[model samples]
Target chain A: MELLMAVSIGVLTACGIYLMLRARTFPVVMGLMMLGYAVNLFLFSMGRLATEAPAVIGRAETHADPLPQALVLTAIVIGFAMTAYVVILIIRGRKTLEHDYVDDRVNERDHGVAEQGLSKRAVAMPETPASAEADGEPRP
Target chain B: MSSHLLILPVLLPLLAGAVLLLFSGARLAWKRPINLAACVALLVVAVLLLLRATEGGAQVYVLGDWVAPFGIVLVLDRLSALMLVITAVLAIPVTLAMSAGTDRTGQNFHGLLQFQLMGLNGAFLTGDLFNLFVFFEILLIASYALLVFGGGRARVAASMHYVILNLFGSALFIIAVGLLYGVTGTLNMADMAVRIAALPAEDVALVRAAGLLLLVVFALKAALLPLGMWLPAAYASAAAPIAALFAIMSKVGLYAIFRVHGLLFGDMAGPLAGLGQSLVWWLALATMLLGILGVLGARDLRTLLAWQVIVSVGTLLAGWSLGTPEAWTAALFYMVHSTWMTAALFLIAGVVVARRGEARDSFMVDARIASPVVGLAFLAGAVALAGIPPLSGFVGKALLLQAAGFSGDMTIFWVLMLCSGLAGLLAFSRAGTSLFWRGPVAEVAAEQPPMPLMPALLLLVLSVLLVAGGGPILDYLAATADAMLQPADMIRAVLGDRYLPGGA
Candidate 1:
């Protein structure tokens, strides 16, 4: 069981890195998601792979260690919110810059569209939940 | 009751952030006072904490009265208190500058500022490794929005790189924490230190790998070379004050290395003593050498300041890698000097951006604001940043060189430190000539209100104080370094009398 878990994490991490290295925002976001999954699983398995064991300490002779479970939950929540944010940001990028490429140097034109956006102070906030998206601060 | 002071640095900002978020749509007249008031209160709290930290032992605030090693904890010592005070000082000017109405460029400027403060304060105070990760995310999220708040194409591209790289870093941080927990069976740093002091032979390799990963995570945060490619563009693109506030962010990474590595792998650790020191020493030199080269290559004032930040990190890391109390003191002193002065430079750069209509601090001599005040402030910041004589930078670098003089390989450290200083001098000289001397003269009639210049001047005042008080300051930092190098009382303070070795 431990072998299976470790190998799965390794594979997920490998895939995540590969995707993250791609040149587009979409793949990068996907890569972050994959990396998040890998980390979550790795954190969960830190307590070791236990079956039919209660998480509550002192519940049984061979109960599972519960700290890693709590850590994993927090990581998952933060990761999910972060992914949602990256999606909003890239959408805005796509609209304004007209390209989804990660590195703007590869295919960007004059940055005038955004500088026009910058020239005014009271420019309306973009139509994203960024103002409300401080992410959940899970105090586990 | 006094111990409660430890938690206020984290809590004041969290509460204030929530309140400011509620008023995000209100008139600036309403939000400005609130932001300034909160920042002043935080500065007071930070000062009190620093005063208390100077008394002796680490002040441990057990959250919810949970026993040590069993729940989250906030621990304030000399090092963390210094961090809190530096952050609070930086926050004041940043808040003051933001209040000048540059904040209208975004929707919740004050709230994001407060949240970023909370994250920095919390990261400094938290004793548990995982809690640090939480604080890092809070800060990163706030920084992300703040970086992209003003909405520029250059900024979005920069934010894209910054966000993705940080997300990757977050994953690595979690993996390291998980692995550390798996090996040591604890998360509290003091307890982990106790455990690592007596770690069994079989688990040594795993702990070493975990420790190095933790180091890498921090190095990435500190912008140690190879891991820091995202910094220059991201920082240079962000609105000026935001980039200025971020000066301390890299220090947080350096701080973690100081706190964690010094505690967990100090000389007392049975077999793992000095685990990452050699690697840090070598890479830090390389980081410094390359960072100076970066300064030479920068085409704009903001990018030059960004690369200078990388250079400061390298110098500080060199001091830290020395593994001596003297070196730590020097590093701390240099850190205090550099963080404030760098932010002052950025704030001044913001002034330049506002005043120079079309050139926008691009280093080309197209147009110039001939305000003597701007030129004076730029000279002060430049002189201080480049380690010129009679400034705080020179004193700080002297202390570092003095400390490094005692190390085994002083030759390379000395050469690199001197070369970095010379590089800074040349870059700032070129930037200065182009900015002040070569640019075409312009009418000063349409000058923007000097409100933003207020904060930059204030930061310069702080830098001057650093030079005037260098003697006493180094003495105090020496004591702080003493506590970090020897963590017995810190551990005892956190674990109470029930502390045990190799026992849960």
Candidate 2:
């Protein structure tokens, strides 16, 4: 049983790392979720992987370690929330930049041109590059 | 003061944040004053706690009346109290800055700020490793929202990277905690320390692996070299007040290292001796040098300040990895100094950006800013950040150098620290001259909105006070370092005599 769990964890980690190194936002987010799952499993297995054991005391002669279960449960909840937040952020990024690439320099260059074009205003607020691209105007 | 007062700093912020979330739709004018009042109250409570900690040795608070090693515990000692005071001090200026129009750009700014505070305060006080992980997630999630608050594409990109990187770090953190718990059969740090001390020799390798994993997690948060790639752009893109508040975030990671390493792994003869110390020492030096290079190459003031934050972390960790009480004391003093100075510099960068308008704090632009007050504030902040004499930075650096002299590798640290200071001086001078001296005269009579001078000025004043009150502060930090070096008091306070060989 321990060998099976260890092999599964190894595979999950390897897959997560491969996806996380991708350039696109979607793959990175997916990678993060996979990694989160791998970590949760690793944390769960830390209690030595008991079968047919009770979670609470007074139920069985030998009970499973409840602490790692509790810890992994908490981690899963937090990981789910973080994954949701990151998904929303990436969707917003795609909407604004019209691309899913997580490159800051490209975004900054486009945003900088927008700011320069709107320099007449005091704030010089950043504009969506998709709109600029739609207008077919060359950025400064 | 009741002993239960130890929980107030964390609880107050949690309650205030929940209340503020309910009032998120209220007018900014209404929410602003309440947030300011809560920050002031937190500051007062922090100061009182600091005083109480100075009088007492270590205060432990148990949840649900469960004994230590089984229940959650909040340990308050000199180190946690100092961290709390610094967090509170930082909160005041940052809250003021947010109120000065930055908060209007985002939703739930006040509530997120309060939640961030709760996370920081709780992270500093929690004795259980898992609890620390929980607080870390809370603060980090709040930071992510705050980072992308203004909804700029650049911010989105930066926040995504920051969030992803930190999420990885968090995953590693939980893995490490699990390994530690598996080995020790306990999650309480004090109890784990006792267990690790008694572990059989054959299990040392497993314990060392867990320890190294924890170090990697911390080094990521502390922005140590080879793991700090996300800091500069992420910090530069955030709103000014949020960036300033983040000045303490990296320090929280350093504090964890100091606390865990000092308490659980201090004995040199132990199995985990020399585990990651030499690696930390060299990485710290490299982080300092590379960060200074980043400062020199930065195109804008905010990015420069971001790189400077990395440099400051490097300097603090370099001193801390020496493993001497005096070195820890100096590191503690430098921690306080760098937090305020970097925060002040970030606030001043915002002021500069506001005045420069289209130039947007870019050093390549030559727009003249006519505010004498701002120019003076920039001058003071720049000088202090570069470790010039008569400021707190100078005092902190001197203390660090003195402490380094006692270590065997004094030459390397001295050369790197002085050279980094020189490099910082040159960068700040070049940037200052280009921004202030070489700019064209103001021609347009356009009326500018009033700059947020109060928070920046307050931070500057606090930096000056650090210089003026160096004597007493150093003495206090020295005592704090002494208490940190002796972790038995903390263990006893938390576990009573249960972990000790002979009980009362």
Candidate 3:
């Protein structure tokens, strides 16, 4: 049981780290999500890998350690919140930064509304912002 | 004071944040005053807490009547109370300055600020390792929002890096906590200390890894060298008030190091004692050098101040590395001094950024801002921050250097610290010249200033107060340091009877 748990954790963590190193924000977010999953599993297994035992006391001769269960629950809540936040952050970044890459190496492929989990082109550029109105058009 | 007032620091801002959120649709005038009122009450509570802490011994508040090692606890010592005071101090000015106009540029600024304080206070006050992680997330999430509060392309870009880096740190933080709970069988920090102090020889390696992982998370927060690249751009790009409040954020990490690391790996831990000392020492030196280079290379004032944050962290860590009573005292003293100094400078930078027009706080601006009031305040801040004579900065450095003298190998610290000061002097003079001399005097004026400089100048005046009251303050800090060195007593206080009476 311990070996199985450890192997799965290793695989998830390895995949997460690999994806995290990618240049685009989408992969990075996915990597973080993967890491979050691996961590939840690791935390769950920290209670020493018992089977079918209830966390409730006095119901059975043997009981599971309930602490890690609680810890995992808390971590899951926080992880869910952080994932929601980071997704929104990426979507916002896509609109503003106009590229999906973590660092600056923008090219032709990144120029439009964000789709496929990458940003559309930036909404406006400081030097040459695109607008519906012509140049020198005054506010109504 | 009632022992229950311990909960107030965490609860007050939480309630305030909730109130602010409920009133989110309100106009700026109403939001501003309400936030300011909450901040003032928090400051008062912080001062009372600090005073109570100065009376000595760690105060532990058990939540839901759960015994220690079983449920959540809020622990306040001199160190934590001081941190709360510093946060409250920075919050008010940051809020005040933001009220001048910047808050309107962002939605939910008032709510975010209050939540950020709640998180900061909670982190300072938490006794459980898991609770500490929760507080760190709260603060980090709020800061992520506040960082991009004013919404610029640069702000979003910089905040993206900040958010991603912190999210990674949070992941590591939990992994460390899991490992710790696995080995120690408890999440309450004092209990963990007791367990680790008498840890079996075989488990030492695992505990050591957990300890170091915890250090990495805190170090990342503290912006120690390699982890700090995101910090400069992120801090530089934020709206001025948010950046100003952020001056205290790195110190939060250092605070955790002193609180959590010192508990887990101090003189008590048998095999793992002094685990992170050498690594911390060398990194601090490297961090100082990097800071000096960053300061010199920075073309903009805000980034220069951000690098100065790194330098201050290095200095604080250098003091902490010794683990001596005197060194602890000096680190605390220097922590308070530098946090205020940095916040003051950021505020000043905000004003300068506004006054510089299109040049926007770059050292190469071609205009002179002719406010005598601002110039004098700038002079005071620069002189003190550079560790020149007769102010808090000089006294802080001298005290830390004095503490280092007894620790042996004081030579490298002395050399690095002096060079950092020299670096400060050189860089600030150049910035000063460009700001005060090179610009065309008084040829341009903007609309009403974006933020007030009074709060910044008042914080600079706080430097003078630190010096005048240094003796009593240092005495309290020395006692606080002594208390910190004896983790056994704190464990007893927190654990009450659940702790084994005798150990290390």
Superposed model 3: Cα runs more than 4 Å off? A105-140, B406-408, B442-449, B497-504
Candidate 1 on B1-504: residue-level lDDT in tens? 565878998889999999989877788789888888899999999999998988866989999988889998899999999999999999989888777867877788899999999999999999999999999999999989999978889999999988888889999999999999998889999999998988899999999999999999999999998898889998899888889999998999999999999999997787899889999988999999989999999999999999999999999998999998988999999999899999999999988878776687788888776778988999999888888878899989998888878455688888888899899989998888888778687433354433379899999998789989888888789999999988887988899755655333
Query: Candidate 1 regions off by >4 Å?
Result: A57-61, A108-140, B406-408, B443-451, B498-504
User: Which is better, 1 or 3, measured by TM-score?
Assistant: 3
lDDT of 2 at B259: 84
Per residue, candidate 2 scores C-alpha lDDT tens digits across B374-401 of 7788888888888998788888899999
Instruction: Classify candidate 3 by CAPRI docking class.
Output: medium
Models, CA RMSD each: 8.8, 5.9, 6.7
Which has the higher lDDT value, candidate number 2 or candidate number 3? 3
What interface Cα RMSD is found for model 3?
A: 1.0
Provide the TM-score for each candidate, comma-separated. Answer: 0.93, 0.93, 0.93
Tens digit of lDDT per residue, candidate 1, span A89-133? Answer: 999999877899998866632344333434332245445434322
Once superposed on the true structure, which residue ranges of model 2 sit more than 4 Å away at CA? A106-140, B406-408, B441-450, B501-504
Global lDDT of each candidate? 0.88, 0.85, 0.87
lDDT of 3 by residue, B1-504 (tens): 476789998898899899899988989889888899999999999999999888767888999989888998898888888899999988988888888887877799999999999999999999999999999999999998999997888898888888888888988998999999999899999989889988988899999999999999999999998887888898899987789899989999999999998888888888888889889988988899899899889998899999999999999998888888988998999999999999999999988877777777888758878887878888888888889988899999999999888455778889889998999999998888888777586443455347689889779888999999999999989988988888766887788755653633
Write out the backbone clash pairs for model 2: none
The digit string of per-residue lDDT tens for model 2 on A47-120 reads: 98888898888888889988899998899999999999989988998898778887755555566555555453
Candidate 3, DockQ score (0 to 1): 0.55
